[model samples]
Target: MKKRVLDVGNCGPDHSSIKRFLAKHFDCEVLQADGADDALAALRGGHIDLVLVNRKLDMDYSDGVEVIRQIKAAADVAHAPTMLITNYDEHHEAAMKIGALRGFGKLDLAKPATVEQLQPILGSAD
Candidate 1:
């Protein structure tokens, strides 16, 4: 089965970029969610190997970390690994403090380090 990645709260361009990058380099499916509700529904609906939540939701300008917190609070979906997508170190640290794994920024989507970080979760395209 292909790995599944749930991407939450990114804007159109960033979502496209992320989908493109993941499609090019990993044999996984990328699912989209616009907010915490949508994300939680998607998480409970199926198996998601990893979750990448934008630092700030474009849909309503809400805190993405709060979404992560909600996911962590839910017992059924909390087992899924999550990451915060942001360029700021402070934001990354903040997310990590709340049970998120290391995440990559939109700016670093194609970087070597980002690829390395994703490899373990999504593996490589076959």
Candidate 2:
């Protein structure tokens, strides 16, 4: 079975573009989550191999860091590696501090950087 990725964010143009890119390259199912609560609920549903957090989530939760923090705190999905997607490269430290494994710049999605960063997280560790 293809690995499943819980993509937490709003359905903006950029977000939809990234989703398409992910679907094209990665052999995984991308599950969309609109907010922190929604993301947590999906995590609870099981079979998620990765948790991709959006830096500017539209819901009241505001930031991806909060979403990452909550995912790490959850007993059922804490083991699922979380990554932050952002336009700013500087957010890497902030994401790490919030317990995200790492952060990837959204502009890098179409480039080699996205694959380089995500391959391992998507179960390419071997």
Top-lDDT candidate index: 1
TM-score of each: 0.96, 0.87
Off by over 4 Å in 1: none
Tens-digit lDDT track for model 2 on 48-104?
A: 888888888866548888788888888777888888888776777888886788767
Q: What shift in Å separates residue 19 of candidate 1 from its native position after superposition?
A: 0.3
Candidate 1 clashes between residue pairs 3 or more apart in a chain or in different chains: none
Q: Worst 10-residue stretch by lDDT in candidate 1?
A: 117-126
Q: RMSD per prediction, one decimal?
A: 1.0, 2.5
Q: Give lDDT tens digits, candidate 1, residues 26-125.
A: 8889999999999999998988999999999999899999999999999999889999999999998988898899787888976877887788888864
TM-score attained by model 2: 0.87
Q: lDDT of each structure?
A: 0.90, 0.78
Worst 10 residues of 2 by lDDT: 117-126
